[model samples]
Target: METKNMEVIYQKVANILVEMIPEEWEKILLYAEVREGFSQIYFYYYPINQKQPVYSLDIVDVFNIDKTLHRKLKQELYECFEKLWNEFKVQSQEQLASLTYILDNMGRMKLNYGYEDISEISSEEKQDKWEAEYLV
Candidate 1:
């Protein structure tokens, strides 16, 4: 694939991430370039308190660029976005207890059913389940 095409895809991914995590939009930084005939993309999100930036997320080793992987990557990116959005909402509501509970339960859920399967679970259901398990 051409570098321009890869850059477009990278931009799309970055846009999706911003839309999903609006709170982190200002904090997020995206960089993409072609190195050695391969596309390289980076995602960085820095917190307000942190002096040094942190590399909290990434998608590396992207060699074979195709439509299938592009679609799958978009889906996976959205799944992660939804999860992060849910976490942010819970945290904003001052539901620390519920947040922790959900994190733990979601980890188990991921372990049992896998991340792809967990994506099928609605955001509301996730929130409700966490509330039931911990907030109540």
Candidate 2:
């Protein structure tokens, strides 16, 4: 697809995502079936490391679009797939990991951990704290 069309379609994709996605979601991954006529589009979300996507949305019948629009959307979808997917993967992983850790240790929490940079808190300091607190 050409640049102008691609930009418009990118806008369309963003609109669909914004409309469909919840504010709390970390990221969304979209997959489209490219075809000359009507095509199906699928959306995936990874809330965890799992065998399949945690959430899926089927955009095949969105607005009862005609074949021409569907074809155009498919082309744009195909072109934009890689960039969108890569971004979602990179951004979601860290957020999901942090959430998982907090939830898994909610009842048994002792030490506090920050998801972002913690270079100031040295490993030796942590080991000393643990040994002092628990070893006695």
Candidate 3:
């Protein structure tokens, strides 16, 4: 696919995120970009009044996907989004905790991406390492 089309795809991905989780749409999406020849899909989220994204993930090895898998990817992602949204919805906190989902499969990525308390963003590692790698 063309590079500009990749941007459009990322935009569509971002839009799907907003559509999936309307309540926290703004916080749910910061940007999407196809990098390294589409081998990676970067998903970013910036919280309100925050300069940086609280969480992120990079879906690894996305390039060279078969057309059938590519189509299925979107549907599978929507299903994941819905389930994660439900998880977010049921939390008892008055304010939603800083939430992040890695939702990764099919390739290796460094970020855990598994569901966890967003507040527990580690102090062990520098924030910059965490800043990269958004879940897509």
Candidate 4:
């Protein structure tokens, strides 16, 4: 997957988040994955502060994004995957794209935490570790 597309998606999401998140939310981690034609396109957000354990919530509710905006974001996700398929298919001898293109990028302003592949670490474990290291 192209890093540019990921950056764009992150930026769009962050722009909306900036207006909605409370001042207490020191940082927010976004986990997005697209597997099997948007069937697994789950967007889970973990809002963190130094005083509390990291917790997950659906971003739409967390940010109070309405259905129209949610649908637009979902469409953007699908478009991104389509772009990936188009780019990858040409590079393959079989002329078929891989089904394992999942986007799980995490960024919060100047702080960026690298995520392990899905097979390596679960999102809950990452939240636990973050809480242990950063929270009171």
Each prediction's Cα lDDT score?
0.36, 0.39, 0.36, 0.43
Q: Please tell me which model should have the higher TM-score, number 3 or number 4.
A: 4
Of 1 and 4, the candidate ahead on lDDT is 4
lDDT of 4 by residue, 85-126 (tens): 444444452322213221222443432333333434565674
Give stretches of model 1 more than 4 Å off. 1-13, 19-25, 35-37, 56-136
How far out, in Å, is residue 123 in model 1?
Answer: 38
Where model 3 places Cα greater than 4 Å from the true spot, the runs are 1-64, 93-136
Clashing pairs in 1: none
TM-score of each: 0.27, 0.35, 0.27, 0.40
Residue lDDT tens for model 1, 1-136: 1234433433455555444332322254433222122322334444456544334232222223344655566566544334433443445532111112011111121111112223445555754553354332
Using TM-score as the measure, name the better of candidate 2 and candidate 3.
2
lDDT score, candidate 1, position 76? 61
For model 3, residues 1-136, the per-residue Cα lDDT tens digits are 1234433433454445444331232344332111112212224544446565433333223224344554465565544334433343455323222233332222112212223333334443423454554432
User: Over all chains combined, what TM-score does candidate 4 have?
Assistant: 0.40
lDDT of 2 by residue, 77-98 (tens): 5455444333434555332111
- Scored by Cα lDDT, where does model 3 land? 0.36
Q: Pairing residues by index, what is the TM-score of model 2?
A: 0.35
